[model samples]
Every structure is written in structure tokens, then in C-alpha cells.
Target: TNLLGNAIKFTDRGSVRILLHLEHGGGAPLYRIDVIDSGIGIAADKLGSIFEAFVQADTSVTRRFGGTGLGLSISRRFARALGGDIVVSSVPGQGSTFAIGVACGPLDGVAMLNPGQVLEAETARLAATEQAHWQFPAGQRVLVVDDGPENRELIRLVLEECGVAVDQAENGKVGMDMALAGDHGIVLMDMQMPVMDGYMATRLLRSQGYARPILALTAHAMKGFEQQVAEAGCSGYLTKPVDIDRLLAAVADALGGRLASNADRAAATPQAAPVAAPTPIPTPALALAPAPALVPAPGPAPHAALPPLVSRLANRPRLHSSIRKFTSRLASQLDAMDTAWQAGDLAELAALAHWLKGAAGTVGYDAFTEPSAELEEHIAEADSAAITASLQALRGLQARIVEPESPADQLNDIKAST
Candidate 1:
């Protein structure tokens, strides 16, 4: 499917075809699939390198056709793992065909459903799951504080589906005001925002004697952030693309109901200590090594590696939809950051980078975190040239944000490989 998708994406005005057949070789059966595309084909010299991770035919290809250059690498890995191999044939200007051959045992007693039937059944199952309603305590209000409009909406949609009432604030100041004005059962506070930040807001809330359970919502899942959240007097913490089940579990636990296990909750909660001057939370970008310079002539695009999305939420279509929406918004956010940089508004630029850093991890765009963090540092140093380079690198990273495949698709690929 990935190969076919890429084929179509690269093809300007040509048909793509898929052919599947069976063959007998050495007393065993083999399944052969061919994906043929009348698209911009690979150069003979670059053909072998294309299957390597981060290696595209050219840098221009990445700008023209967006991809992380990971699909073919992953596909090849899957093929090899399944006792098969993927071979490609291409012409510079004509087209390309990818042949995937996997070894299969004799099918004498096997029952096989048509691929279309299996796909339809799986789609139906997913649809049914999406339609199945979940129930939560009525009027159980939660406060969500984040600068991203799309993120706020995504969280609201997920929580509202579970029958929770949600109030949102665009920044820490508004969050602080709303928290004081309303009776929220719990507060989901983002660690980085303008006008104020989660750390300051949390400290103020604690100092002022408002004692509702506050869960730190952060983009940085690196070491020490949990400690930072704890030090700030938050009750708990959650990392982004917040999983639905985990979010509900956290909420329920915060509200003194145990819908989900509390094993991890202790880590999120503050460890009791005598009050002292707060330890400054280190910026997440500082944790990442600087990315290598972007080579205009691409062999492999500079790899900005990120951890995979949490598996529990990866299977859900709603999460995927949310991710797509978040990534779409990322482009505009980058643009805004550029504008802020051009205007010499370091505060605005820092705030945008901080928000972008936090939000990127939730949607499996961890690669963005480092560049964003670097942007923040550049703004702090008042280095205009560094800011320009970092912003440009961020735009490049944005193109490489790879969406993970569904679990079902993974299983199917595994089965095909074997």
C-alpha cells in the first residue's frame, strides 16, 4: 500500500497498477506482487540507495514529492524479514516497477479470502469501534491549557466523546484565570506557552491556595521533565499526542476515581519536599544534539529521528485523524514562527518554538522538537543567522514527518512477509 501510495504521489499523469499472482519454486509456493507506476522513475545509479533509510533519489525529489524516504527502507526490511526481497527496475524518464516476492508454503488445506473482502471487513470493524459510545461521569469538568487551537480541539473532541466537559485557554495567563474562575475537576496544563508558562502558572496556583489536581501536559518526554512538573507543584504529567485511554485514566485518577491503573500516576505526581527556590527547567532542545547541516545535494536527507507514536493509540483512527490535523496546523505555526523571527520578536518566537516543540512529540513528530528547541536558543542569543538556518531546517524536518501504519496493516505486512 505504501509503495502504491508513493507511486501515485510521484506520478504526475500516469496509471499505477498492482498485480498479484502465485508461483511454484523448489517444492514451495511463492506469492508475487508487482506495483508498477508510470511515474518519475529512479536513476540507475541511485536505485540501490533509494531503499536505504533517509536516502531519496535527489534532494529535489523531497521538495517535489514529500516523504521521509523511509517507506522503501521499511518495506525492504519487512520483505527481508519475511524471507522475501523487493527488487526495483526503473528508467530515468519512463516509469518504475517494484516486484515483491515472498515465500509461502503449499496452500492445499488453506482457506484464503479475497484481499478486498478482508479489507472491507477490517474497515467495518474499525467503523463499528468508532461508533461505540463510551460513558464518563456527567459534568466532570477538565481545564486544558495550550496555545495550539488544533491541539485544544483534538483534546476536547476526545474528552467530550467520553462525556467530560472541557474548558480551554490559549496560554498560561488565561489558564490561570479560568482555573480560578471555574470549578474544574482537574487541569491539563501545557508546560510552554506565552504570557506565562505552565511552571509559573502552577507555582502561582499552588501559592494562591487553589488545590485542584494539576496534570502537566508537555511535549518533552525526555528525562527530568517529570521532575520539573513535580517541582512546579503539578499533581501529575502527560506527554502529547495524548492517548485517549491514558488521558481518561489520568483524568479519572485525578478526580479520585480509578478507571485506569495508577501505577504510572505516582511518577507524574509531585514528590513531597520542603518549599525552596524552584529549579529552572532545562529547555528540551538542550537535550538534543544539533542537527547536521542540510546538504542541498541529497544522498540521504539529514535524519531527524523521533520515537514512534505510542502503540496503544496508534490503532485508533481517531488518533490518526488528530495527528493529520495537528501536522496540517504545523505548517501554519512554522510560518508564524518565521514572521515572529523576522519582526525581531524573540518572545513570540520562543513561545512559538516552545509550543511547537511540545506539540510535535504528541503527533510523532519528535524530530521537530530539537530544531524548535534550537530556534528557542537562537532567539535567546539574538543570533539572526542561526535563527534563519534553524527555521529552514525545521521546514525541512516538517516534510519528513512520517505517519505510522495501522496495526492491522502491520500485521498484514508481517503475514505477507512470511
Candidate 2:
């Protein structure tokens, strides 16, 4: 809060103390934090209007302590919004203490940490941030083997930013051949893919004396899965909802050369096409093109907002830009899924579901992944009734989303070329 900052600014020598107190009342617990400081104290008259907007102790104090006087006002508003208030006590020429009390609804299931632990956690986070800037080898190629076009595209777009060339394989069969033929630094192999999954491809490659690192990608994080990955001859494994930093870290671990912090791709070879910044398409809504069969809307409509699939990409701007393309592709996949369902092709249905399971989460349609995976499970079980039910459930999930009014716009032209 501003009180702490203000205290720090005014106090030149003595220590500033933050004392925390808690009380249990009729309702939720109330937390009161007192920021005490040994500094030039406020006059008794000024204490009355100190909480007022743009008002500080005095001109001399302002000359000594520089701040906009906005942080306190905003923080006061927030405190009141939570059914609390901030009060201050000071003696002229002595010191000042400001206390804020607020009701915290619940502490259930929260992991509490002390100041030392928090500082340690912050230190680790900074190290990860610096490591993210640590460069991979320039012009090093990484092979991405997966059936989902969107998944492959997501991996390619991220790696290319770090000066890596990416080659795609729709299935493990092709991945094996590419691994043998190309000079790739590492392989990111998706486990549940069509035409020879990652396990078989890795086994085949290792059998043929291909010594490069093969990292398995899977949605399954069940207990004891790492043993299976080791048995499959993978160097390690990564899970779904493809995280950008985790992907980079995995590649770093495999290559054993995480050096440098600032460098661009070598201009000698062009990187993969950069995804355009998200802009409105001509069509208002991006999903459910050639709309599939669906049941009635849900019991309650979801509030209009960015889906979790897309929202998580807010930090990775380049990768985030591909959202429009992912939604456009989603419509086509829905149509294909419907067609496959009409013909009762379980293998095709499961494959489409599997792809959707990975693709939906990658592009911010995370809620869609559950339904897609459910449909895939039913198909794998070879239960026609469950498959039909699960298919309807998937269709219903798209139907429930409330549309945002003209969310993207005039930027459509910028989006189209990509």
C-alpha cells in the first residue's frame, strides 16, 4: 500500500515496521495491518483530510517526499470496497502509524507462506525469467511430430522466435524418417498420435542407433507414467496445454547448452511465419463453423470473456496472435467430426477428438478439451451410446458461450495476410 511507500520515502534513518493483526468476528476474519514509521510526523489537523484526494501533509513535506498522492486514495477506495477502512494516528514531531482493516472471506485451501519463503520464491521466479532469455543455439532445428496441425503450429511459432527451424510430422511414421534424415538438435514427440504413436517411433529410432534426445508429449499425467516414458526410450516427457517456458526449459535440458541471454535469429535463414496480432475476422464468431447438432443451451449462460485457452497466451504475443487461425480451424474440425459421426467411424472420431483435446487447450478453448477428451474416451471404449452422448455434449459446450459484442475490429486487414 501507499502507506508503506510513503513511510519509506519520509524515513531517512529509523526502521519501518509492518505489524499484522487478525480477529475473528461474527462473520469472516478481519485482518488489520499497521504500518508504523519513525519519521517527520503529520500535524493533528492534516490527519483529518490526509485520506482526501491529492492532499498531502504540507508543501514542505511534498518537497521532501515526492509522490502523486494517488496510491493512497486508490488503496483507500479498495479497502472501503471490501467493507473496511484505513485510519491513521500521529503526534506532531514524533512519528506516524497507519492501519487498514479488511474482511478476508475465507482462507480455506490456501497455502500460507512467511516473508522469508516469499522472498525465496521470488528469487526462484527471477532466475526462471532470466533463463527464459537464455538463448538456444542459433539455427538449431527441432522436429515436432504430432497429428494436430494447430499443435505443430503452436510449437513451431514459439521455437522460431528463439532462432530455431521447425520441421513438422503429422504422425510418428513420418517423424521417424525425418529424425533419420534431418540434422535436428532434439525431437518433441506427441504420444497419442495416429499412424504409429511416439512410443513406437522412439523405439524404432533408438533401435536404429539414433542417439538424439526424444521427449515424449502426452496429456496423461497419471502416477508412474515416467517409468513408461523411460521404457519407451524417451529422454524425458512433457505434458499437454503446451506451456511456452516449459517447452523452452525442456529443450534446454535436452541440449545441455543454455548459454547467452540476448540474440536474434541469424538472418541467414528466414524463421517460420510470424503469427499476426489478433484482429477481428469478417465473421463475428470463430467457432462452430458448419455448425454441428446440439442440445438446448446450458442452465446458466457463461459471462462473455476470453476463453482460458486463449487467455493464457496473453504474455506470448506472437503465439497469442495465432488464436484467430485456431478458431477458424476449429470450425472445420467440428464439421469433420460431425461427418465422421454420421458415418459411425469410431477411429476417425477418436482421432478428431484427440486432436481437439490437444488443440483446444493450446489456443485457449480449455473448457472444450474436457468434452473432446470425453468423446475420445467413449470411442476408445467402443461404446456407441456413450460416444453419441459425448458428441452431443461437445457440441453443447460451444453453444453455451455468450458472444462478445464486436470484440475485435478494423484490425481485420492486418490479420488476414497471415
Candidate 3:
């Protein structure tokens, strides 16, 4: 944690990453955890004593970066106590790498995570089990239309894991073209974007006689927005920062009849929420003799307690590579927003905000999501004060958007594309 914290604090540009690998030595298996940072690097001269208490590369680094410098000393002592050592390498201006080597427990018992874990977790939270409930049958596909790369990627990842193939389009015009050009179980459409928006796209698709379900994805949840989208010919409406379950449920519902035609798979429709119906209680007035002391019935075993909120993307192996790609581009995504905002391109800014709002939340960056949504809303409302405040909040999160490389990656620097 200390190493990661330091890396992020000094890395104003580029990235911070964690790398891990198994090292086979003379007797034991050693695990190496490397925290790499593209930050102001330490000089060769200071590398020797830099781990000492209250020490840094120089006074200037201390003043500029603001640290009391106890983190490394404490970390090293802990590492040494565990029969491991923390080490560092650096190029004065480019970056630095800090690695700690430690022994691990036996690996013979290690197993890949089970998919049942997802069911237990999801069922505990949503009170809905049966993983097969949302799993589409063979040859099933859904068309996902959104201008945001992250949004499209997230939906694609989640759907693909459920046996549903996906086709993607970036904006309404392209989405409209694709919708007409192909056959799909359903179309998930983002209601706002450049070069055209979802409402127009759906309208055009409908006018042209394309009749498959088109589910509207929008951030706007105002009083009459549902009716507005319905009038646009959307089969269903879902608000943004799209909940994984809701998206799955809506798509499954849209694919209802289609599921029946494919491979003997049942079309699973979610039951109406139980809250919608009131359970009646019989008056106890006539219950004499304490209801005859009835014994409790043995029902199903209790489910595991609901775990911490996990992203819909979590628990799937397919998500790893996509997250790496998203993380690598995070800096430039922020850059795009700044440029759009400076140019007073409200449409462009709103599109960017819309993407950030959905993508960040989808990717487990909860803090980044709400502000992104606020910025989008303010831009739409043309409220200068709210927009500026939201922009500032988003700018603060930019510093925190540093990508922590997955422990499974070898800690390679993800070079930003030129």
C-alpha cells in the first residue's frame, strides 16, 4: 500500500502499475510484487541510503512531493522481517521500479475461481439465483450502441460471458445502419451522442421497418423522459451508470420469444418484483389455542451473506485484458474532456461526460461516476456554475485515475498511443 501510495503521489503523468510473478529459487517459490511508477525518479547517488528514515532523493523532491519519508523505511523493515527485501531501480527522469520478494504458501491447492461464486454473490444481493436465467442460448447475439468505448466494452464483456455474442456501433447513425444491416436478439442504444442520438436512430430504424427490440440507455430520469423514449420507439428504458443486472434483465426480457426458438433453452422473464404485490395477512381473531403450536418447516439452506458490491465485470476472466486497455487510455480520456470543455463544445463535452459516467461506474470507479453524471446533466441544462463545479470535481479525480496494473500482469508499461 505504501509503495502504491507513493507511486501515485509522484506520478503526475504516465502511469503507476503493480507487477507480480513467481520466482523459483534454490528451495522455495518466491513471489515478487513490483510497483512501477512513471514519475520523477531517484538519482543513482541516492539509491543507496534512500530507504533510511526521514530520507528522500533530495530536499527539492521532499518539498515538491510533500512526504515525511517514513513509508519506505517502515515498508523495508516489514519486508525484511518476513525474510524478504524491498529494492528499487530508477532512471532520473523516466521512472522508478520498486520490487519486494516474499515466499508463498503451497500452490498445489490453488484453484481458479468458480463461476458459482458469481451466483452466490449475485443471488445474495439481488435475491435472484440460477445463473442460467440470464445466459443466452447458442448463436444468440445483441447489438450494443454507445459512443463510449468503455460502455460498449463493459457490456460486451458481461454479455459475452453469458454466451451472448455482441455487435457494437459508436453512435446513432452507425448504430442505425448496423441495426438495419443485421439480425440481433435486441439492441441496447445510448440516447445521447455525436453524429446523431438514440432517439433519432430508433425512429429511423422503426420507420424503415426494423422491428426488433431497441432498449434505450440514458442518464436522464426526469419525470416524462420514460414517455419520451417510449414515443421514440424504444422497447424498454434503462437509466445510465447502467446496472449490470438491470441490463441483463432487460435484454433477457427483450429476447423472450427469441430464446425459445434457440436450442431448447427456456425464455426466462423476470417475475414481477414481489414488492409490487401486497401479501395479505389473515386476522388472528379466530386463531384460538395459539395456532396449535405448529413446528417450523425446513426450507432451503441459507445463502452466503451478500459480499461487498462487486462489479458485474468482476468474476469473469474475460474482463482482465479489457480493463488493461481501458486503464492505459484513462489519461487521454481525461485529456479529451479538458479539450472539449475548453473549446466550449457542449455537445462534445456532454458526450464525453456521458461516456465517463457510464464507463467509470461500470469499471468499479464509483467515485468518478457520480461527478461525471453531474457534469453531463449540467452541460445539458446549460448551467455554467454547476458545470464548472462538476468539471473541477472531475479534474480532481483525474489525479486518482492512475491505473493500478493487475497483479497478474508482468508490470509492463502500457505505452499510450501517439
Candidate 4:
């Protein structure tokens, strides 16, 4: 019931049914309780191990459906502790049934709600509360340093959407210089950039006695990067492509006086030298903007008066033109994502899709956000039926961004040009 209850929480349009079978013998009555669901079923090979301690069927499964793998393991343990064993039968596309057998006990007063009703209520309450809180601060300054145009733009879009003024640096050297010159409240520093990477930049900042919070942004490859990020002199670390809620929370934490700890630093270890540049993973059907590409062509410029919000976007001496340039670059990335989807290279399509979901919502592309989110969900599911449906919806969204209200027959004219 516990495991079934959680599955219902994550799954929509799934039926949860419990089957109870009783075997009466001369000695005692044995009871078998089975909980079945039409939701996403566990893979066959994984079904056996899911009940093992500390093991998850897949990491993304955990991310998409949040849980500690301990639930089933604990449930089995409790069942065994009470002189029964639990078993499972599942086929990935079909459904799953978890059967628990035990010695029958006395009748008791146990209350259960209609699963549909409870789940709906919980979902509604959570959605309502989420809509109401809306706690991000307005117009805070944020500096983003990343080598990839996609990454840079994604962060820029996110912060900008929350009404935070944003600035960008393509590499560590530039970001470091910007950090030294600007009066930013926070720095979102990416780990692997040309000229200077996040670690070197962080070390430099700390050496120069820079006290502002710097958050290292990297793909959390393993547990080690967490510690490496901290040791590199960052106050915190966020994994990419960043989750919007997590990113906002980290930003709020840094801004609201949450300080990094030595333990956090010790936990993030440096990644092993790479044999090859990690190929950009396709984001799951999310809308992605291109990474930020800053202008200036490595030349010196005279200082100009920046808006108060822009001034705080960096420690840089002047930021008047940079802010506008950065936002413009972000807009371009959104166009790029739209283009990728039309071309239909699944890899680029998925990457841009995932990026846009996070980027669009963060940057306040109000119309595109929810559809982008739905696109990501369908892409992650990746079933043939779901993907086809999602693809159509995505094309519709692309039309909205690039070609609203054009005649349906002429849609291809506005489709991405690969």
C-alpha cells in the first residue's frame, strides 16, 4: 500500500488496484496482498533489486519521481520482520504487481481513502501552494560564466526571468575580471571554460579576498564533483542543466546569507581528466536557448554609467551595454532551440528541448513555459506514442514563438532550417 500510494502520487491516468488472496490450511490462514498499478512499470531485471537496500532502478527515475530507494527495501524488511516475504512481478510496458504474503492477523480498524480522491487533493494543494509562494527576489544582479553558449544563455534566461539583472562571461579569465570589477550579489560560475575554469577563478577570487558567494555550476557527474566544486572556493554547487527551482533556491540561499562550509568544499572532488569532451547530452524535449555569446572582441572600452541594477550585475567597472547584449543573446538561443526542433535531429532536438523548458520558464517566456514543460515530460517518457504526440505539440509551440497565426499550410516556411 505504501509503495502503491507513492506511485499513484507520480502517475496520472493510472489505476491502482489491490488484490488480496487467502489460503486456508489446517494450521493457519496465509494472506497474500498484491498492489497493482497501470503506471510506469519497473523494468524486469530491476524488479528484483528494487527491494534491495540503497539501490534505485535508475537515477533519473529518482529525479523524475522523487524518492529514496529505501521505501521498498524498508517495506520488505518490515514484512520479513513480521514473518512474511514480499515478491514483485512486472513488465516494463504493461504494469507492476507487488505481492506480500504473511500469516493472517486479527481484524483491525484501518482506514483508507479513495486513491483517486486523495491524489487529486494532494496534487491540487501542491500546485496551488507553488503558484502562491512566488518568492524570488526582483532585479538582483547575477553574473554567469560559461564556455558553452547554451549553458550561458540558460542561466541568463533563468535569472532574467526572475527579474534579476544578469551579465555574462565566456571564460574564466573574463569572468574573473568581471567578478573583480562588478558588485554582483552572486556569481554562477561554470566549471570547465577555456583560459580559466571555475576552480582557478574561484581560487583567484578567494586569494584576492573576494567575499561574495560564488556557486559552481557543472553536471554532477558523480558524488565527487560536489566536493571539488566546494574546494574550488565556491560557496555552493548546482548541477546542470540546472533545475529552475533548485537554481532559484540556491540563489535565494546565497542571497539570504547562507554561507558555504568547509565540509561542502571537502565533499566536491575534482573530476578525472577527460579522454574526450563530454558530448552535450540531449535535454528531454525541453526548450533550450543557445549558450550566451558575449561581444567586445577582446578590446578595451571606456566606462559608461550603468543603471543601478546593471551595476550590481557584476563587479565589472562598466556594464551598461553588456546587459542588453546578454539579454539579446538569450533571445537568439530561444530561436536556435526552435530551429533545432524543426530540423528533427533527435539529439539536437532533445538537447534544445530540455534547455528551453528550463530556460524559457526562467526567462519569463510566459506562453512557451508550460508547453515546454509538457514537451519535456513526453520526451522523458520516450514511448513512441508519447514522443509523436509531444513532437506535434512542440511544433505547435515553435510556431507560436517563430510564426504565430500563419496559415497552417505555410507552417513549413517557418519551420527550423536544420
Candidate 5:
């Protein structure tokens, strides 16, 4: 799929072809699939490196064609996992072809059924079963505490459609107050915030005998972050750019009193067993509501103004309502960052950079990810000049983000060209 998809993506003027056939060797069947594209072909020297993770043919290729450069690497791994391998051949100005070969073993009882059909059926069954575990009981309410208004609004919109009442707080202090005063069935707490961080807030709530389930919401999907949240007394953790299905499912599991222990939460990965759902409670008066259509807001004017939010959710009305507030908050953070740098306050600068990096990506300012990362490295090395230079570059990128096209549009254009 990856090879074919890539072929289609790069071949703007010509055709992409797929050829599949079976061959026999040593009295055993072998299947071969070839994807060929008349696209901007790979340079001979770069062909091998393209299959390596995060190594595109060239930096210019990556800039012109957006990808993390991991698709082919992962696809090769998958082919190898299936007891096969993928090989590539290309010419600099002509085209490229990828071939995959897999062993075809004898089928036993299920010989009558097509393998693809059987796989699809089993996948659908598992999806249905997983979704069933995310159905919540009646009258459940969830609290979302995040400094970013857009983040909170997005969560609220998703949960409300799932028949869950959502209340918001701008920071952990307000969140702590609400958690103590209100009877929330579960809490989605942001780990990083201006007033009292989520870790401290969670600790306070735990110490004050607030027993409801708490799930940490964070953009830092690093090694120790989940364990940190678990140690702070959270039931589970969800990383941002939050997936709507996963968010609702986590809440449902928490509301159903199926929270995982700290140890389990710390070690858990996506492939781990899902939390068990409790017996269904009586159905409440509320019913599932259809989500509204997303329409993009007016683009921001050019120049020193903060860039408009450019996420997958940019067109969502609920998220649009919080855009100004989100941008304003980001602007203030940048100003504070400047102050911290001038004052040689490395600690403050690092903290602000960390917060800005997380919040910027959450609100869809993906251009900031790299510069923010660079700023963090500069701060760690105590390189003031490099930090200043990176900050200026970030501001320039933010200012130039006027009316940038959404990734969805780019994808559609690629499909049309193919």
C-alpha cells in the first residue's frame, strides 16, 4: 500500500502501475507484487538511503513533498515481517519501481476463503468489539483542564456529541477548584499549564480525597511522561492532537470504573489489552448528536501578527471560536520568552519554550515544532545567540503563515493529480 500510495503521490504527469504474479520455487509458491511509477525518480546514490527511517532522497525533496520519510522504511519492515522483502530500482530522471516478494504457504481449513476477505472481516469484528467498550453510562460529565482554549473547546465538542457533558478550566488552579466542587465522572487534565501544572494539581486533588478518575492530556509523548503522570495519581494518559475516538473511549472506560493502576498505566502501549468496560448503567435522557460541519474561518492578515491556526481542526466552528484567544495566549508566551532570554533566565526560558512547543503543536502551528525544538537545544547548551536566532526565525515563520493551505487540501490535490 505504501509503495503504491507513494507512486500515485509523486506521479503527476504519468501512470502508476501495479503488477502481481505467482511463481514456484523449490515446490513452494511465492507471490510477487510490483508498484511502478513514472514520477520524479530517485537518484541512484539515494535509493538505498530512502528505505532508511527519516532519510528522504534529499532535503529539497522533503520540503517539496511532505512526509516523515518513515513510510517506506515501515513498509519494508512489514514485508520482512511477512517472511518477504522489498527491493527498489530507479533512474534519476525516468521512474521508480518497488517489488515485494512473499512466501505463499499452504492454507488449511480456510482455503476456500480469500485471505484479504478473511483479514478484513476479522479487523471489522475487532473494531466493533473495541468500540463497544467505549459506550458510557447515563448522565456522565467530564472536566477538561487545559490552558489552551482551542484544546478545551475541541474536547468539549467531541465529548458533547458522545452524550457527555464537558466543563472547561483555563489552568490547573481553576481545574483543581472545579474538580473539588463539581461531581465530574472523569477529568482530562493538561499536564503543562501557566497556573499550577497538571502534576501538582493532580497531587493536590489526590491529597484532598477527590476520588474521580483523572486522565493526563499532554503533547509530550516522551519516554517518562506517562510514568510521570501515573506517579502524579492519574488513571491514564492521552497524548495530543487528541483523536476524537480515543478521547471518548478513554473517558468511557474511566467513567465505567475501569481505570488502570499506575504501574499498568506506565507500562501500557496501544497494543496492550484495553481497559474492561463495566456493566452498562440505565440510559440517560441525552442522545448522541451529529457533529457539525467544519468551515474555515477568515485568514489572518500578513505581517507581524501571529499566524492563524492551521490544524486538521482549523475549520471546526467550535475550535474557531477559540482561535483568537489561542493566538493571543501564544503571543504573550513569545513576549515572555523574549524577556526571559534577555534576562539570561535559562530556567524560565526553557519552561516557556517547553510550554510553547506543546501548546503551539496542539493548536496546529506545526511550523513551530522544529524551531521550538532548536530553541530547547540552544537553551540546554546555554547558547544565547543561537536561541535568539531561532526565536527570530520562529517569529518569521509565524508571521508568514497567512492563508496556508490545509494538509487535507494537499492530499486531495495529490489524489486529483494521480
Candidate 6:
């Protein structure tokens, strides 16, 4: 269901066809279902591994598909639990075929259909229902593990506001301690952290049989992480700047309880909490994050050799605001274009290119978006350089935006260097 759903999502002009080949024998019929799509294809070596659960061919696919990777793994488990299995094959430039084989038999007779399992499945179903009167109960707890203060605070703010009580740990060690000590409904785990990252923490949790949901929260919302996260025993995955709606939906689905998606975990009206004085800083004409340590560029270049200069300047408040606005807007724009490219929407591709050109240039990314603008002007000409260069710039920008420190800290770095 998850793979098919994503196939439909990412395939616009192409056809998605499901072929069922059924055969009768061995006192039971064999039902073979093949979901074939001319969408983004998986690489040859990865074809064998994707069914291993949470495995995707590429990171770009995960951002486009927006899934936890549990869907296919769970689906496969369901198939196997019924004495059936799933097989898959694909060619990177071609397409993919997911073949699910099932034995025809009375489900009640299946040993996996016990009453407890039945009840748990039904609870999950009810929890997934979109009914308004169905309240899943408040004070339900979740353990959030992240090394970054901003990320933890953002998640804490979002979840606590939803009436779901929240607990937090900055590193894996603390997270494991709290997780093992308490009976929480779920764990929102960050994959990378200090002392003990989420991957190790989850491994430890699972080894101890902590059955509640454990979801991976990371900026690397790529395909492979899903399977990797699952190996760590996490139930699902959530990308950064966590989408409130998707997060709640996944949590509700995983925890067997319903929660309001509108309930922002981070929302809170300040009461007695003291407000700190705001510091002022200069906003370059274009605000950029400190570049990443390793960029996705095609070739090798000293990461620090990249240019670090101001495009324009703003007041202190504007500088802070501009940085946030700058980083977020570009990330969102690039992400959208990637989605559009996958869907093969030329119009959207053109529009995104145009928008990026305008926004990047406005914020001093002319060095980046300018090439893309020229490409947009002659998309029919197939300007690969423009496209490749633009992508490289975006990659470079991601590094800059997510420096070892905050944009605020980086600004100070710039001042000190100056």
C-alpha cells in the first residue's frame, strides 16, 4: 500500500499498472501481485535490499515519497506471517516491479491471528480513524532524542503543545536512560548525536525489548536511513523541522492512539517565563547558512575554499530574521524543485527555476540561482551545466546554512574574523 501510494504520488505522466497473476494448486491458490511503475527506478544492487525494510534506492526518493519505510517492511512481514513472501527487481533508468506472493487460506486459521494480535490491530485501526470525538488520551508520553538544542526545543514545543506530555534528552545516553526507565508511548529519536546517537540508543532499546514506537528524526531524510533506522529497531522516521501534521499522523498510527494534528507541540503562550533581550547583527544582502562540512558536489574541493562574502547588509533584527527566512526559503524551494523533477513536470520545473532565480538573486544567491535562471530561459535547450551548477550551489548553501553553529553564532564568527 505504501509503495503503491508513493508510486502514484511520484508518477504524474507515466502509467502505474498493477498486475496480478493468480494460480491454483497445492490445495490452495497462489496470488501474485506485481505493482509496476515507470517512476524513479531502484539501482541494481539495491533491488535485493529494499525489501529488507526501510531501504530505499536513494535519499532523493525519500524526500519525494515522504514515508517511514515501515509500510513496505510491515507489509512484507504481514505477507511472511501468512506463509507468503515478497520479491522485487528494478533497473535504475527503467522502472521497478514489486512482486508479493500470498497463499490462499482462511486467515482465522493463521497462527498469527490470535485474539491479542487481533485486538492490537483493531486498536491501531481505531487510532487511525479520522473521528473527531475519538480522543486517544492526553499525557501520553514521547521521548525526544537530539543533540541540537534548537531541534530538541522545536520538537518539545510542538509535542507539549499538543497535550501529549514530552520528555527530552540531548544525547543518546540520556535518551536511553530515560527511555528504559519510563513507559512512554513513543520515542522520537535523532539519528546523529553526541555520547550516543539515536541509532545506538535504539539498538540498545530494542535489545531490552522496548516495544513502543521509536521513530528516526534526522536532517538526512534519505531512503537508506529508513532501513538503517529499522535495523536500530525504530518504528518510523521523521525529517527535520518536523512537519506537525505528518508527525502527529505517524505518532497516532504508531502508538494506537489518536491526537490532534493541529495541536502544535511547540506552541505555548509565555506566562512567567522571562524574556531575554534581543541581540543585533548585520544581515548580508543575502543570508546563507554556513556551508556543510561535506558537500554533495560531483568532485573534490576544499570545503573551506568556497567563498564567504557579504552580498548586502541589514539591521540587527532584520539580520536574524533574514537568516531564518533565507535558509528556510531556499531549502523549501530546492526541495520542491527536486519533487517536481521526479514527477517530470516541466511546467513546475520552469516555475521553480524562475522562483529560485528571483529569490536567490534577491538574497544574493545570484552566484547560485543565476545559472538556473538562464537554464529556465532555455529549458528546451537542455542546459545541463545550468542545472548541475544550480544543484551544486544548493548543496553548497545547505552546508552554509547548517554550520557547526547557529546562523547567530556564524554571524559572530564573521564579525570576529572581520
The TM-scores, one per candidate, come to: 0.49, 0.55, 0.52, 0.43, 0.54, 0.35
Candidate 6 per-residue C-alpha lDDT over 137-241 given as tens digits, one digit per residue, 9 for 90 to 100? 656887878765445554555556556677889889999999999978888888866688888999998898888888897655556878888788988787654
Per-residue CA lDDT of candidate 5, range 324-417, in tens?
A: 4556677677889889888989989988777666666665666566567657877887765667777776666656543334457669999999
Model 3 scores worst on lDDT over the 10 consecutive residues at 284-293
What tens digits encode model 3's per-residue C-alpha lDDT throughout 1-418?
8898788666655677886666555555556787887777778899888899988778765434445567899999998787778888877666788888776655553432334654554545443232334656678889999987878988998888677889999999999988888889899999987799999999999999998999998877778998988999998888777787688878877665222222222233222222432222222121111111222235542111112333445444567566556666767877887788778899888877777777777676665665676576567777766676677656666554534347544344444432
Candidate topping lDDT: 1
**Model 2 Cα shift for residue 151 (angstroms):** 1.1
Q: Model 2: per-residue lDDT, tens digit, 1-418?
A: 5688677555544557897756455555667777877667778888778777878778665433334455678888988899777877776545677878788666664444456766766665555555446467666889999888778998898888777789999999999999999999999999987789999999999999999999998877668889988998999888887876789888877666475532332222222332333221132111111212223334443322213233456445576556656666766788888899889887887778888888777766676765576576566767666666666656655654422213354367558766
Question: Could you tell me the TM-score of candidate 3?
Answer: 0.52
Per-residue lDDT of model 1, residues 337-363, tens digit only:
889887988888888888777677656
Report each candidate's C-alpha RMSD, comma-separated, in the order given.
17.4, 21.6, 21.8, 19.9, 14.7, 21.3
lDDT of each: 0.72, 0.70, 0.70, 0.59, 0.70, 0.60
Instruction: Write down the worst ten-residue block by lDDT for model 2.
Output: 284-293
Tens digit of per-residue lDDT, candidate 4, span 1-418: 5666655533333366776555444434446677776556667678668888768887666544434467788898888887677777665644666777677553233222344656665665545444432244555688988776655665666566556778899989999999999978899997866688889999999999999999887643456787787787888887654565678778877666232234433333222332332222222111112222222234333112111112122332122233334345555565665566556555665655555554443333433444454455555555435445555544444443421222443466667443
For model 2 the local lDDT of residue 316 reads: 52
Give the clashing residue pairs of candidate 5, or none.
Answer: none
Specify the poorest-scoring 10-residue window by lDDT in model 4: 302-311
Stretches > 4 Å off in candidate 4: 1-117, 133-139, 257-418
